[model samples]
Target: MSAAALPAKPARTPTTPSARLAWLDALRGIGALAVVAEHLLPWFLPGLRPYWFNLGIYGILVFFLVSGYIIPTSLERHGDVRAFWISRFFRLYPLYLAVIVVMLALAWWVPVREAVPRDGSSVAAHATMLLDVVSVGGVADTMWTLSYEMVFYLLVTALFLTRGHERSGLLSMVFAAAAVVVGLVSSGAVLAGGWPAYVSCAVFVVALAGVVLGRFRTAAACVLGLMAVVLLLMSSRVPWLGVAVLAVMFAGTAIHRWERGTGRLWPVAVTTALVAISPLWAIESGWWWVQADVWITTIVLAGATFAGGMALRGRRLPRVLVWFGLISYSLYLVHHPLLKYFVQISGDLRRAEVPYQLGMAALAVALILGVSALSYRYVERPMQALGRRVSRRYRGGLQRGGDTGVAGQGAGDHGVLGHEEGQVPDRVRDHVAQVDPLR
Candidate 1:
């Protein structure tokens, strides 16, 4: 059928279970926890460790994969490019802005004897999410990842707006690939000139991975395997490649379903064994490869763990982790600045001994959790609701103007409500339309 002549989707039943994509939530939670562990590494161990076992880095790969999987789904479901952008802005911007503002306030007000010197340029770049582009020192080291995320958001938004037509997907893929080649070639030169070259390279790798996986599902698995080998070889030269590799693997895994049986145990066992051995090897040899191995093993373990969790779909656990997943983004953005502030406030305590450092780390985590919960409950949730309402109204207006397309469907369908596949009831469609007057 011609695209314009396609019929509207039939309304799903209201009594049907809601689609809740818990896997994404669980993955997000895992990412957040990995970041927390990465930050707390120094406190837990002696000396200034590079924090290579840092699951947080791999968690970003998961983030990218999750976004790739969900954005297309959102476009398919919502059918409105404007609404998708609106929802994304609502979901990400408020918390991001709030974190920036809070960080600024702390930087301005907090007194510290040994504060990292803040450059005006750096502050501006970070506040605008243009730190990587501007080559400014980030307000927080972790903010580097946010720069890549912002770029990815823009690219994905473009793809969503174009609705996979105009060969926009192909165009995006080409651009992303070009970016990687350029970044890798220019990174060393840029660094020699005193710029943060790794940031560009990292962002390009992420974008390239997204494009490759989004475009070629069958090759996705092979690409991931190849990237893993490259990452292992280049761990010291381009540590970020390791992250890209993990991301590719995660994306590949998400695209394919492995048979559920006792046979899954072998890979899980090997992955677990590798993860367990990695840290020990890292501590003993102080080799970067050991560190890389640790992260790779962790990513494998995380994948296995996610599979296991999915297997336990219906059973209710403590849900504390799931709750953490809900606020994971906020937690991640806010954690570093909060940690910096804590270090400043408790400098003397931190320097006391290993036990004291550990204690401070615990206290920092508690504060982050508390602050993130409040941010989610009061700030993020309300903004999200407002964004959805605005998107619905805007799209509804478009529909009334005779724009009868799938874009009339609300953004909630694209995994925003954390719904899973096969869970969206036909009846719920009517309810959504009645309630929002836009879906």
Candidate 2:
């Protein structure tokens, strides 16, 4: 058989411009929107609520699944794990630090004491990406997931260092095994009365598994899904294990879809099931097993929705949603703190008044959007340009020395799967070339 006749293997492409992946972008926007709605519930909507913001929890799962799909692809593009980590640090840390600094300044200068609690534990946790690890409260409540992303990055880098990009199967197994070990260890610890350590370790393990195995071929997805189901059944008896299982399953399923390709009707079916049944299942089953089941369902459904939307016949996302996707990360990181500050300063405006709350919400959204745009333009873009320059220089140096794979020439552009569609442009490549002294 001709090579072209066989089923194509899944491979990470380098970053380049192509048609945008609207499904993933749309999913990100939806996740961010859900978060905004959940936060607004306390101030705006009352008595019409159902199930205590569980939808927000599901939104978080979508974020994780999307992360799993994208991060490894990013590592593969840069050709050097150390460089990838450096780039991630540049991209994530500046905004994070800026937010912290702003919050601290506001606390001291504005006479509002609310920013004080945002310091200490919350600040420490956010700084370290260990919010859940340290049990901090007021920092960025949504930052708990950033901790997971950090852990996943570390694990993927380790895998890349040891295995390069050749042995994806082996990498997937290692990831799965690590998760199992963590889950078992955490479960034992919980049974032994060290619940804090147990929860922390368990969370780390599950997230690790989610990122690693999530890139594996489709078969692993079934195994991960079944494991999640079993974990849900056992969660009432062992809550930590249950959560870990759900994470693993969600990652596995997302990876499977990413690898195998999404069919037209699949996402539609999955999203429908989740939107219609998940909440009701949670309501009926209560918090015990329901949390696990609902989360697992949410991830699967969100992934499907994204994939399906991307496969749509026409443009799947409006312009606004695509823009939101570009800046979603900044929005996610900045929104909570900004909202808290807004509420604190607007105390004289009658917090209970519907109009006041609505206005505050609108103002918060605008601030988040504006700040995110500015940050992307001034902060992230420059650093990304710098990283590309360094990478090209390093690659040129290797090429001059007659090194082949070191520069990852055969590797396509670094294609982070879930983000803006298409490969990195030639203009970016040439601009970086001009800046790269080594070249």
Candidate 3:
């Protein structure tokens, strides 16, 4: 959901982590616009859409890589499981729920996508943010990516708890291998129907509650990690793709490790190659984007983008790009639904004159950006403020010697997530600021 770099040395004071992180924001901004263009071009300028590579996939891959790079590091730095979950909830859910509510309201003007099942399980799946895996369509189309984001969070939490987090490179390769095996053997969802959604939802709620409440924490994390893997393999709409995506994320973590001097780059190289070809033998029909050539191109470009961002991590990126990154989550989640309604009201722009279509597209972008800025200002900021307060209070209680060491360090040693604006440590602030607008 966010991107970060590990500082080689800790600063005595919180210098300018933001400046160092501008490149990641640049990447987030570019990814957001790329995704917007992917949806917009088809509707208003079909002639501009490329056949060689998929813009939407490329943008999301960038996002997933960014998330992989930052999320686990953020968790490890925070060290407090409760505070980590609290921050995540505050950072992601408020805007996510608001978008879902708005989409449901917009359904009166534009019918909900037929991919969504008219069943209560859809509600359950949404609650868990496991919609894609459970084969329940999201209210908003882009919500599929959030399922993977949630899975990564759960897996990282478990790995951190058990001291297995350092094996990211190995984990990345394992998932990549799983993707290859799954692609060879499976064509579609094997654990089909609403039951997976319902059951997973129940398990997610129980495990998350236990973890956050600090009750049987290790057991809860293990259950969640195991459940995440099981769902990816058996319940996902495309099993190979799910594992492949996880491989991409962990590969991002591997890169972060390499940069930080704790790991090698070989696993990252292997992960990239495996993920690029994961869908080559996939038996699915009708998805032209996943054809061997196109899929390979998408992976290569995403990797290149991440590499570019990493290379520029110390430079000042364009302000416009950074601003777009600030509002990306809202833009990403709300734009598709807004576009649907825009089309419903304006009639099909695809059939309109080219100039008129272009004009309409410009207006749509303005509207989406305006709405996203408002959502960020009014929804995300205040919720994050509240999360900080709650985390501080909860953490205060745990500091009374209840906190124990893990992997030879105090679990609550690091302060992340809810640091008051200027008080944030330089090593951690860039990660927190990026969390300001999750992908």
Candidate 4:
């Protein structure tokens, strides 16, 4: 794969300041449905489980790639670290905490996996959402992905603060190479057993907190290096999967950089090919990735899907799908728990006939969508408005506290989509990302 094979970039449009990126919304919509289908079909209608296509993993990797692509754009588009966190906090936590309550209540009735980490550490680690990378059992199995997402956030923020975000392509290449080499040489290594994982997790959390708290900039770099090194070395349950996931995410970020014209397409192509093929080395000579019947199929399909989306950037998509994208975060959160509870309450999932189970799955998706639409309307939208309001007040208030942000008004926002936030939170909604509403 090379730059020559990639699709031509779309022309930039002259639009209003508040213009929405429909392509990302469309991508998120399709990806969210794929995830819902993947989870439901396999769980209920086991007879129809396709051995060849890994819809769940495919959906999730699309999410990771989209997150990688859009998150950095959101961050740099506003160029205010505080405001970015505010948007993320309101965007994610309101729905996340609500889902937690639902998950816990459902667990009481439905008999979900309640595997907590030893010694109550799971509580603290999960409170921060760094459990899996820190080697703690997640509250939900789906949550494992969030750990990698959080780490990616830290790494990107560090790069931006250190004025190195423009080099994301090189970094993506480095992560991909590490994935290949590490996967090939050995399975992988965890940092330390037991308490050390917790301790390191705590340290990283505190450092991140400090950085987000508008403290010294050095704290940002410190936490970034510490967490990155630890994550690179820590593989725990799976072998090179962590590295591979990170590589995939960074590959997204790399593509984003190229799309914005600060980077070359060649590195992005190289990184994607590396990420698509990296798993071959990680799969023990005999075993294969749980996501795929054939690993290459997963990579090829994902690449094609993304490239196709890129090629048709300005095209119009169905209204239903775009609306689904609007409520994707709520859908992603509540769908799993509702489905799990439905199974538990129904009792004897395996005993149900394929036709009956398929009907139930469809109903579950319908219910999830209805509830998600309401959640998005009543919950996410209002909270997001509050977040933006809070962002405005927070940035203005920082001046009173004598905390000059990462950079002052005069600094030109330099990287991809980076802008001079002279007003800080200028067109703050630009930072609102519909992709990977994984929160």
Task: Quote the positional error of residue 408 for candidate 1 in Å.
Answer: 9.0
lDDT of each: 0.46, 0.45, 0.76, 0.62
What TM-score, computed on C-alpha atoms, does each candidate reach?
A: 0.62, 0.61, 0.89, 0.84
Error (Å) of candidate 1 at residue 112 is 11
Candidate 2 regions with alpha-carbon error over 4 angstroms:
1-16, 47-53, 109-128, 134-138, 164-301, 313-316, 348-356, 397-439
Lowest lDDT sum, 10 consecutive residues, model 2, at 424-433
Clashing pairs in 3: none
User: Which digits, one per residue and each the tens of the lDDT, describe model 1 over residues 1-439?
Assistant: 0111112222333322222455556666776776666555544333544444444445654554455445545554665545655666677667777766666676566532121235443444544353434444344445545544444344444444344322322332333333334334432112322233334344434543543224432243234333323322232122223223223332322232122111222332332333333333221224342345664555555455555444444345447767777788677767766766766666534246777677766788899899988988888778878887776667766556543347345545533553211110010011101121111
Steric clash count of candidate 1:
17
TM-score, cand. 1 vs. native: 0.62
Of the candidates shown, which would achieve the greatest lDDT relative to the real structure?
Answer: 3
Q: Alpha-carbon error at 216 in model 1, in Å? A: 28
Q: Which order, best to worst by lDDT?
A: 3, 4, 1, 2
Off by over 4 Å in 1: 1-19, 44-52, 109-128, 161-184, 188-295, 309-317, 348-358, 400-404, 411-439
Question: Which 10-residue window in model 4 sums to the lowest lDDT?
Answer: 422-431
Q: After TM-score superposition, what is the CA distance of residue 107 in candidate 1 from its true location, in Å?
A: 1.9
lDDT of 3 at 426: 9
How many residue pairs collide in each prediction?
17, 16, 0, 0
